[model samples]
Structures are given as C-alpha cells and as structure tokens.
Target: MKLGISSASVTERYGYDKGFELIKKSGFDAVDVGLEQYGVESDPFKLYHRSEDEFCTFFDTIRKLAEKWELEISQTHGRCNTYSMDKEHNAYVRWVSERDLKATSLLGAPACVIHAIVSGRFPEHYQNLEFMISKNAEMYGDLAPFAEKNNVKIAIETSGRAMVNGREIKGCFSDAPVFQKMFEAVDTRCKTVCVDTGHTNEAVPFGAPKVQELIRLLGKEITILHLHDNNGTYDQHLPPIRPSRGTVEWCEVFETLDEIGYSGVYNFELNLIQFGGVMDEAVRFLGKYLRYFIENKGKLM
Candidate 1:
C-alpha cells in the first residue's frame, strides 16, 4: 500500500505548503487535501460559506506545493454535510462540488471525497433524504462531463451516524448496505467510495473483517482508504492500535489489502485535537507505526 497523510492533521500550524512539506518529510508518498475544512468557514455545524477567489488561491497553492515536493495529490475533500436543507445550501453544495472537482482535476488528483449526507435527521425526513440524493446526483451529473474532461473521480465518504426515531442511531450510515445503496444510486466510474476506517469503526460492528467485506462488496469501485484507527467508541483518529474483538486489526488490514489487490494510497487521517501540541511527535509515532507495517506487510501478505 502506498502511504499518505491527510492535510487536516496540520491545517492550523502549517497551512498548505508547510503541511505538504511535513507530510513529505514524514515519509508519506501522497497527501489528501481537506479542501472545505481548512481555508474556509465550512464547518459542519456552521453555515456553508466561502469565497470562490479564496478556494482558487488554495488550489493554486496546493498545486505548487505538490509540484515542489514531488508528492501526489491523492484526493480533495469537501464539507457537503455542512449545508442545511435549503435551496441556498443546496446551491452552495453544488458550487463547492463543482469547484472541488475542478481543483482536483487541475491538480491531477484521482478522487474527491465528500460526505453522503448529513447525519441527524436523514431517516426521519425520507423525502428530504431522497431529494438530497437525487439533487446530489443531478449536481454531480452536471460535473460528469467536466470530470471526464479533467479525469477526476468524486467519492462519497461513508458517514459515522445513523438516524432512527428522529435521532441518530449512533452508528448506522457507514454500513455496507447503506454504502451499497449510495453507490448503486450514484453509479458511475467517476463516482466512487472512500472508506474511512475511523468512520467504519463507529458505524460497523464487525471490525476489520467487515471492512474487508465492504471493500470486496464495493469491488473496484473502492478508490481510496482513510487509514485511521478508533477504539470502537468515538472516531478517535488515533494511530493503529492492537485490534480486539469487533475492532480492526492493522496487520490483517494490510493482509486484506494485499489479498484484494488494493494499490491506492492508505492515508493516515488523525485529528490534532487529541494529539495537542505534540503534532509532530504524534506524526513521528504514526510514521514509525506505518514503517513497521510496511516492513511487515510482505509477511502479512
């Protein structure tokens, strides 16, 4: 597996250039850019708002950084779930999708990852959910030709929430059935899935085997893998820990990847909230963990 790290880990301190440099220095082969999370006021709980010029400048900076570091721009991520169920929010989602896809294409990234839908009220509001899916497809469809022209795929991330009885069912949306349905409805070579291990830990109960099964079910449609570990409670975005019952096995994960013939980047997706000021130290820890895995992956395979 080619190793990578997400830009979200160092968005506060390094910005784009230093973040890319740190990723490269840490022995990562690629970097996943969290486009909407950083450099914009597009937090999930906040209003979706950002200037086009700002995003353009962000894209330009990333492109230059990628060139300078000889790093592959693995994917671009957007915050689609931040939008509320309104016409204006829907328009904003469309605009962000188009802009992110264009930027991904320009940067020669293979895929762009975004949430499938907002978590809390989706199950209670079936009509709105259906409308959102259809609208998302239509909006994404508008970019199909452009995606074809630019050679970038749009990937819907598996979410970590479930809706039941007008409330979240803790962990539900990231299940294989849900992902299968999303892929079926949004079927296209340019549209795919990005399996986030942390989200999967929150949503699915079957551990690493389940993750492998989902990848198998998704088949070649699985384009990217977000390689963060969780402790089966919250999305702890921590480094890979020892696996337990109903938890993912890092070694087994690498084995499964080899068995499935996965050649994409295995991106580390940690959050700095828990790591605190020891971001570099945390990265080094993760780097050592990854190096151990890489050196031992052949045995596992």
Candidate 2:
C-alpha cells in the first residue's frame, strides 16, 4: 500500500506550489486531494460552477503540481451530502456532484469520495433498512452515469456522524453487512467504498463491524481509504495514536488488508500537524512513524 495524506493543512499553510513539495518531502507516495469549496456568499460553488475551461484549469493546476512533486492523487473528497427540502437546492447538489466526478478525472484520481444518502432535506424515510437501501440504490443509479462519463468511480464513504434529529432517518449504511448489500445494489463499475477508520471506530460502539471485520466484508470492493485515529467515540481525525492505545488496531488493520489482498493507498484524512511541531519535520515524522508502527509494533509499544 502506498502511504498518503490529505493536502489540506499544508496547502492551507503554504498554498499548492509549496504544499505538494512539502508533502513529497514528507515521504508520502500520494494525497487525498480536497475538492471541497469554501467562501463567503454564493462563492462556495465557485469551482464547480466555473466555465468549462476554467474548471479544467483549476484541477489541471493541482494535477500538475502533484506531478511536479512526483506524487499520485489517490482520491478526492467531493460534496458530502445535500440539504434543504427545496428541489432546486437538491438539483444544485447534483450539479456539484457531477462536477466532482469531472474534477476527479481531471486530477487523475480514480475515485471521488461522496457520502451515502442521509437524513437531511431528503424526503426518503430511511428508518426502515429496506427503504434506506432502496433510496441509496436509486441515488447511486442516478449518479453512476455521471461517474461513467468522467471515467471515475464514486466512492461512498462510511459515516459515523450522528444525526441531529431524532425524528429524521435512523440509520445509514455504516454497518458492514448493510454496506455490502448496498454495494451489491449499486453499479459497481462506477461505484466503490472508501473505508474511514475514524468513522468506523465511531460506529463500532453502535453495533457496526470493527475495522478488521468491515475489511473482510467489503473485501475487494474497498477501493480507497481514510485513515485516522480517534478515541472510539467520534471522528476525531487525530494523528496515529500509539499502537494499542487508540480505537484502531494498526497491526490488525494491515493484517486484514493483507488477508483480503487490499492494494490501495494508505491515505490519511487527519490532522497530523495538529501538535504545532515544525511543519516539515512534523509531516515527515508522522509519515515515517505511521508506517513503522504498522510494520513493526515495537513489542506492542
């Protein structure tokens, strides 16, 4: 597996030009590129809403920068979910999701991480597992054409984020069995799974499968990863904790990957630089140490 991490923090500090170079220097083989839009007013969708050429230029610059640093863009994070009861708002989200696929292809990423359908402004009452599966199947079917057109696959991320409303949807496809069934329901050629360690940890207490079991369940359907550590209660996105000290069992996870023949990027969606260490050395240390811990647990630390 190739070591990878997100370009968000370093890119936030030094912008893309220096960011990719710093990441390459960190010993990472790849990155999980962030395609999330942010700005005041209606400018949030600016990237997705740009003229065709401008959109191409935007992602092209990122792809070129990664290439300049000899780094692969393993995957990208697209729009997470849609909100609001308005049909126009929902349509607008579909538009952004399509652009996400287009941008993923432009960036040379094979997969784009999007969330499963949730209880937002969506009209589907997902309290019933059958209803949730049916709704998500229809949604994936609608998105698959866009995915196929861009020659990129839409990756449905495992969510452990709790719903704020009790009267809304009760569950998502976070459980491994349910997630597997949902995968079978969708068009696999245009869809896959992105196993999120932090979220999986959060889901475990709620009766979802452990990371190892989830890996076995998803098997080859797992095409990408979001590796991070937490305290087993939430999506903390913390740096890799000492082995056997956090929610994830690094040894067991890698072992399971081996057992399942998972050939994918070890991409992190984490705050590895959160401790305020020197940025360059910190990234390097995290990258090197994470792999070392995985490869050799040092007598279980």
Which candidate comes out best when scored by TM-score?
Answer: 2
lDDT of 1 by residue, 139-249 (tens): 557656766767888787876655556654544346676557656776456887788877776655433225666666677667787877776667677666554323555
lDDT of each: 0.67, 0.77
Q: Give the TM-score of candidate 2.
A: 0.90
Query: Candidate 1 versus the native: TM-score?
Result: 0.81
Model 2 agreement with the true structure over 172-203: per-residue lDDT tens digits: 66677877787788865888899988888777
TM per candidate comes to 0.81, 0.90
Residue runs of model 1 more than 4 Å from their true location after superposition: 38-58, 80-84, 118-121, 126-139, 142-146, 163-166, 170-172, 206-209, 243-246, 297-301
- Error in Å for residue 212 of model 1: 2.0
Name the best candidate (by lDDT).
2
Model 1 clashes, total count: 1
